[model samples]
Target chain A: MNDFLFRLFRNGETRLHELNYLFWECTTRCNLHCRHCGSDCTMGSRDKDMPLEDFLGALDTIPESHRPKGFTVVLTGGEPLLRPDITTIGREIKKRGFGWSMVSNGYFYDEKMHHLLMGAGMGALTISLDGLEDSHDWMRGHAGSFQRTVRAIKTASAQRGLNFDVVTCVNKRNIRELEEIHSTLESLGTPQWRLFTIIPIGRAASDPDMILSKEEMTRLMEFIALKRKNPSGKMVTTFSCEGYLGKWESQVRDTPFFCHAGINIASVLIDGRINACPNIDRDAFSEGNIYSDNFYEVWMNGFKRFRDRDWAKRGICTQCKQFRNCLGGGMHNWHGACEEPLTCHYSLLNAE
Target chain B: MKFFRNILKGAALTTALFVFQACYGTGPDFDPGIEMSFHVVSKQTGEAIPDITIMTRGGSESKWFEVGKTDSQGFAKIYGLDYKHNGIDFKFEGKGVTPKDTLINDFSKNFHEIRL
Candidate 1:
């Protein structure tokens, strides 16, 4: 039913005129060996951090007209703070009239780094804290990671007008502790708590235990809904925009499930491969490269596959009624090595 | 005076929960049924208003279910609703007060003060 409707309503080749967000994988080096590290980043990743000049040059390649006002370039990595010249990079990014922020593992992010990054015009920071001390330490594969992350949250919270949020990758082990995690974040004065289920990729692919079962996913949805329905005054809880959740669509998140990859979001990976979201397998989704392809041209003219969703109509998506709204869930859910639509909330939860 | 009493009741509820957690080392067990309390007052006079109808729907597909109407004290206690982990959309309608709609996604938050 959905397959026929999609084919009928599908329009001609769509193009992206401007980018709202750009993810620059500044460094591949990470301080922690997380159990579910999607990028498989390590303390000594062979892929060298891209030179600051390379990113700046790519930004320069995009014409001034194409760069939308308030467009932010998100600096992501195995751990962005691991880069020695992170402050300089932030400053450079700001100088180009673009807002800059980063996602970190929160191991090395302290009070000093928080103020330094903010001084460098850093707009926001997203830190990962999976569960309580024990659960967090286990997921991060470090003993004192939980303590440092809490300290970082405190530092960020203390900074007035500083925007920051703690993201937890919900796994089987920590799934039951969500209420405790929420209370902990609220106590820490954190502004937002973003929950995300682990994607079966990279190291996570090797450990099937990391993935949440259908029942757990439903509970996760209910938990998020409960949080939104009865908000914690100290903090706001939101589920990450990962997949289609049907009835839980606007209930759990601020907006319906829309895959922003290659549409409003794009990425320059650690290896300089241009893709949509960094989570998508780099090889399968690379539109072009920063070294060879013109950034603006590739963004505007290329990414035909990402912009169009007709091809995604195969598999379970063909039968799902919410296909028009979800468009086969996030690209990462169905793309790469995924044998099926592993993360469709409607199908997983059996929501009508 | 009534508003102050309602506020005290909410505080007492929180203190009781805290004491319960302190004793048991965990929060209360998950209850299948959700109970919500609303205290609606007039924005201009700060006086309790009555006969306000509170309606709810699980999602767009579900029909709106009128939770109940406010009483003489301008308070309504709604029970016997299954939250089922779905956020419920609530609509408040009454005479002389502006009708308002609020989405309640968190079941933990039960007490709502609406000035209409």
Candidate 2:
């Protein structure tokens, strides 16, 4: 309950407008090249690590108030652990009473990471999975990356303190293996499988083929529905794409709204700027730089300006009933790369 | 009407427990559709920015569409309308606003506010 949130709720405009989650892209340098990476993350020039002090100092700027629940700081990167100080960073963030979660390709994982993160007080560890092995390795552009990730997850989960989950980006190359991936996680005692609906944003936006069509996404949703009815009894499947559809979100409370991007969750780039959405064009959608500006002011004024726009009448999103449920999925295609609104394909497909 | 509303935690992604039963062609009815208005104001100040023009198609193909300007209350109302003004695009030409041209979306919201 920071001051910004207190004012927001006080004004009675508290419709999921509290910044609860923070996404810190610790580094853009990753060892494996995944085809569906929204950040277009890679090694070499992309490897600009955030100074540990800059990241930690930015935390102090977060307005402290009576929080209704715990705060979460999600550490992501080209593979966050590539930098040795990740554990230290994680430890510092946890010390602030913030829940800590990190996403990694898991190539650098060893027993040391498990112990380090566990000691740092990890809330969960999300590992990237494309398919089982062939599908995952193909998407990752590495031969044995699957073996590496599987081993990493196994080692980390062995410590009861560390929770393991799989984050899969569903694209043409690996849509068929959703079930197989789910079962593997279930077998591993891993609970959740978050399937990200690949939107054409970063490198993928240039290559339209990487983006899934409405039919493809709808079929995937149908598959998810089927899997939900039957008892996988182990792994749970959730879709990032579900946020775009017109429906009540399972995870969202009371409201039909989808994301709290500027409202609640915000992404901090390596340069210390706060972005509206993690997947948005980083340079364009930036609300403000935390180093020079106030995080709360930037988020309230700079970031949340999108919420003021008339999304219900915005192009393809206008006619659909679900338009209100999603605020055009966080103004995603503002770059104008796509021909139509991202969810229009579904509206057309569903209409058919 | 500001009709509202991702980080997945562990313990299984039980979406079944949390399902979105969304059906197309069915949602809130944007009644008395033609009667629409938008308020333009400074997001930083929360006060009105006057003299901004609001251009519109008024949901018709004919260029005999619609246009109006904001009153002292920062409010602008479309003059002539009978059916739904779904295609209305409010091009607010002002000095300090970010969105030069904002499409006036579904009147389901009825009263729209454009904050600069």
Candidate 3:
């Protein structure tokens, strides 16, 4: 109750005036090749790494009006940990009196990285963990990736101040092992597990095999429901609209800023180009380059394109009973998840 | 102590089971068994946080649930909670606020402070 209450009422962690978050793709270099990677993070580099000075300069360009109180900066990538000077990056971000966090594949996380992040005053570490052992290794396309991820979890779990959470991207292949992974998370003393329905874009968009059928998604929702009802489960499960059906299905859509579609969030690619979201095609939606253009203008203009979507002609979103509740589910999520009329998953579940 | 400063907001937010309630009633919907009261306040300003919704899913029925909004003193009394049979899983959301908080502490403790 204390933690939940804190999350509900607190505003200092969320100053009204400050820019909430900035998702910067630190680098495109990664060691693993996950089949469903939206960013297509490869073991080889795109050679589009943002220099430290350039990143800092762009950050500095953020007008003071945007950040009455310093904003949070989430360093992400094909694998942010791949950067040799990640600690220095963390330190520099912290020096500005702003929150610092990283989203990584957990391949490079070890005692050394832990020390560096802790010293640099990192606020959180969101590591990707899709499944248990064989399933995880299969998804990552590496033999020993599972063991390394376990090591990373253990290291992260032991940290006194540094916060950590597991991000499991759900897809067709590894959906069955979710319960087993949850059990493992509990045994390992993991605080939480983030279950994300895989979004089809980038590498995933090119492959039709990655998207989950409506039936598969329904089954997944049932599984999540049963898990939440269980009394002994320690880890909290945050399901998407498919998982938590009903009126709350619109909670995400109504709260636009929290999602990628909202103007508050922006993604910087490894090449310094900006996109509304990392999952979207960079070439097509590259809002502007962070190097040459101002970051604020690019974000406002690029996100306006999404905010002004035409739900009028776009799918079931136009006539659904709950059309007013969720504006076409959301521009990016609708585009990435569906090719047909965007029917409300909740409405379908209710009819059943 | 200011817990937000000590614990990461992301960690806390993810750990919470966020639920939004659109109705309120004390009729047959409640169990009249285990009851709990909560008071919410902002640590930064030391002021009560009113109109925050408090929700929980635990009771005698196969799928029992309860939801309510906080009063002016940031206080709300939740009744019909099946404390003996079900576990504690609550989500407290403030009105018009960007950040969402939940039952990360004991509601019976009377007062809880969140660093805003």
Candidate 4:
């Protein structure tokens, strides 16, 4: 621990601060499509997998100065593990001195595959586990997805250098089972667990009834509060859940910028398209061609365009009480439904 | 008392050596190089945007160079430029959106977005 602290604070060690965050969605194809997925992962009309050359070209655009000291690049997908070249991509990222992370369903954690990914600088693996086996399997639309996810967690934990976490989407169906899910993850020895409130988009948008009500959301927050105070409790981490909930009640309440999609976090689509946030679909938001444009140029120009918009100045987001914190939520949510304020109730509840 | 004073002196010397090592072990006058990358994307869908223009100017009459297009990841490489003394500008025009410009700085980091 002492050594870790020393390294963390070392002046020359670039790992101290993160300059940027990249969410690289290598492929939109997935084996299981969950009902609450914000990205509509189950949809069949998504872009094809990103080509290897295009992937490399994207990596090549990172400016030397702005490169993160502890650069966190998250490789996401319909199921990132399904991509045949994930190991190779992971290796290349590590070679360039970036911290690597992945968000997957955990259905494909084979021994060889895990080894290859770990070898390529896989720092953190976040597997989605909505609830217990029965609940998770039902939500994911696969009979054995829960079991496979648990196995993947165990396998990842048993590895020498891999850190594992579970991401849960809290909704009406699984709100009652959060405690059980927490306990299960803890028992499995997972290092961390993040709970996100379901954003009504993608499949969930098609079936708004699947979303949790304000009362249910409140209950979930109560549970989170209890878990936070209880050291021995099963809950490991609570990301933006509290804040998201708080923001949901009164749209006018100010909160920290929720979606810095364009500024800090970026998503790379399968066909080489880049987006500012994960919320927007490829068809809705195409900033530039990564293959032919300077990454910095396109990003800066995009930000300027976004900031200069009339809606940016006087949209529903402007009237929002929590504009400080919510910041129009994610762009996709804003673009998807203009009537709503794109605020996450969970985020508002946790506001400091 | 004399022996105790000598021991204290020795301890102080060791502490000084450790501090010196911590500060200067890497190098005495090492200049940390600036190495970073960025991604540019559309605000709505989170996809990469390409073919935008990036230009940098240092003085009043600095020449403008057309930086390369963004890759599949909406990322472009700006290699080995000293950002401390230079002012950078980016421009992009796409369908359904007007042309946009931004002044690049250190705080916003790499990934940028444009809305359409």
Candidate 5:
């Protein structure tokens, strides 16, 4: 009995030795094309669906030992749900005993679709909602996307089995509506909310005006401070106060965690391509085809490239103090190179 | 000699198990029923104002409670509030001041104050 117990504990520790995460871009096709979207995701894109065989083959390559204990697979896309075989992909992931999560625009929710996904062991569904009805619709470039998203949230929330979270991208257009968006979420009773800063790339590059200015970010942080002080704050807690504070450059220096991505978290693309993090693109780092190569080989080769200081030679990423923490400034925002360090207006406001 | 080595290994393992269990067992021993007093004051006048209401939200149950009025000095003390965490928010209101507004939130020590 003593020998058996000792081996069991030892094996458990050894199983969790490697830090791993997978981001599966099931499709690049999106229903709504938002103005500030860094991906430039649109309904017209030809390369939409990822072949199911390729996806499953990629999963088979990840050895059971190196597979993380609570192995997290994030299914993202132009819109992952738009793919025909998303539910099948979800089921396959669950069969391998891995946790499944998704990032969607929330326009594809229906009674049948919701049940299929929840049945497939979908752990969490993160939906995008830019602002209140008019503001959100305008930002998404669809007249009724806001209403559809609200209905989808209501539908998803009504389904007791489904876990849903709302993600709002803060930019110049909808910066003022932060409080209103919070109130809307409160009214809907959504459990979790995440506020992400916009990365400049794709359409965002053409319209520099869309990006949030330094002054706006400062005001937004002040409002968040006030909300924290409020006793009746109804915002559902998904992330910690410390986590939110680190998003600001001024507070980031004090935070102990330099980069949680590529170590604790990672992003896998649809074409058997894997990235070190979700916020980066596949072309940035294609270590090897996931179908042909094992995770160990790909991870080691890709991680070296990811950790490369060539960004310093490029002159954009090297000079920035927040480089260690920022982790290549979110993959979608990588637009070749500009003279600037791709600093978010929010960080610049607090920058010394 | 083999039997003796196995016995030594077992003893070391037992000691490590006990140490792990002890570390996990030691945690905060909090009394849920115990309540404390909260005070609110104006930063400008340093005078305790009357008709300010305070409430607690988020937890098992949401409860609303009234605090005391200020004396000569701008200080009102409200009691019988239990908090699981140190940081608790209190909303304050007066005739001229904004109603349903957050007053006190930061709680480093036991005695917490809201300066409007």
Candidate 6:
């Protein structure tokens, strides 16, 4: 059967069951310009930062029935700490009966911010740590960032119930330094660690050195598999759920490959546009605007493109035997410029 | 007679399995997209201005992409430009007016109404 007919008869991944996670792009301003930053956030970003009330007002638009129990709003941005009112935002989010967390580079985060945020109902944090000093500084395009981030990690990890996870963006430059980075994280008393390879977009799209080749990708997977198998420190390490990795799926990550963008996860961009995932291209897949449309209505009925996978089965995806299992990789992996999916773990492994 | 009965049962079982698989099949998951719109008006008379060109850039040295131009109603919009810099510079120019520049430093609001 054809793609449309098949989808019509079958219950596919396009269905929105419940809202478990929501990412709010609070701001687009960051202190550093990372080489592989998908959002290309810089210190001089011109995007206006949303006020605490704006996000709260947008949250009110999502009816309680649409969200699952204990739903959390994840605040992500150029750097969430750039906003002076982050604590107030967290407090307001808590007032609405939802938990809150943040994704940060750990540059400005310290003991004081952690205390303030925790008091304001911050439950978790995911901080980026690309590599050891030199490699990390180079990737971030800033000096002394690694030291500041490491200090923040230590502070966060020392606290109980902070649920800190140190995420590293693996690239050609840092691929060799994974072992050292892991050791550094373990020493910092990190509770969890995640590994993700760069998607070729933004600054990364222009820099060929930022993306890993098939062989290098295998090495990264093998390294993760080894870490998972070996008795490491107290830290629980897993590869990020960025794409399907065939045999490495169960070994590297806690669960099998799944792109939870629209179904269970959604994000509001700085410009008031709602999308399934933060990394997804806003031009092609925006569901609706928080300013003009009701959030619950958009969540329920507006993700037509997100819920359908029939169109993604073109190009190299059609040739892969794992297409049915991988579903053309993650939506973020689709390079609109090239009109083909990039970084297929299945295809990469098969190439070997 | 017994052999014919077995063949019918086998075919029925195959059809049932196919139907079950068809209804409960799995595939790839969710995605996203967004856009920002703008409106320009006269500062002196509060009249909607037309033919205004809105050029956007991430920073001082970043390349500029013409997001959109104001129409007869002074409305324009932008989406899917591959630039990722958060800080943006919106420069407005028209046939017979002083060029103006505005800064939206973060991903805050989508709709902007500017009076030139």
Model 1 lDDT tens row, A233-330: 86878887777776776678664455657766778888778887788868777999999988877888888777888788777777767777778887
**DockQ category of candidate 1:** incorrect
lDDT of 2 by residue, A207-295 (tens): 65566776777677777666656756866665553354433233312233344455556778888888855666666568788789877
Regions of model 3 farther than 4 Å from truth? A1-18, A68-70, A206-209, A231-233, A240-260, A300-302, A310-313, A334-352, B1-116
Q: Rank the candidates by TM-score, best first.
A: 6, 1, 2, 3, 4, 5
List residue ranges in candidate 4 displaced over 4 A.
A1-19, A42-46, A158-163, A233-235, A241-257, A281-284, A305-318, A337-339, A343-352, B1-116
Whole-model lDDT values for every prediction:
0.72, 0.60, 0.58, 0.57, 0.55, 0.72
Query: Per-residue alpha-carbon lDDT of model 6 for B11-100, expressed as tens digits?
Result: 853232121000001111011112456788888988889989777652224545354568799976544222224556778889877888
TM-score of chain B of 4: 0.47
Q: What TM-score does prediction 2 earn?
A: 0.67
User: Which scores higher on lDDT, 3 or 4?
Assistant: 3
TM-score of 4: 0.64
Question: Rounded to one decimal, what is candidate 3's iRMSD?
Answer: 19.2
Candidate maximizing TM-score? 6
* Better structure of 2 and 6 per TM-score: 6
Highest lDDT among the candidates is held by which one? Answer: 1
* DockQ: the better of candidates 2 and 4: 4
Per-residue CA lDDT of candidate 2, range B9-110, in tens?
222443221221111000111111144567889889999988775654321133322255576889765422222424555566666666466655465666
Return the lDDT, model 6, position B113: 87
Q: In candidate 5 chain A, where is summed lDDT lowest over 10 consecutive residues?
A: A237-246
Sorted by lDDT (best first), the order is: 1, 6, 2, 3, 4, 5
DockQ for all candidate structures vs. native: 0.01, 0.01, 0.02, 0.01, 0.01, 0.01
* TM-score (all chains, Cα) for each model: 0.71, 0.67, 0.65, 0.64, 0.64, 0.72
Tens digit of per-residue lDDT, candidate 5, span B24-108? 0110111111233445666778766655544433222334333333334444333222333345556566667655555344444
Model 5 regions more than 4 Å off: A1-17, A158-163, A231-234, A237-258, A307-340, A344-347, B1-116
Residue B94 in candidate 3 has what lDDT? 68
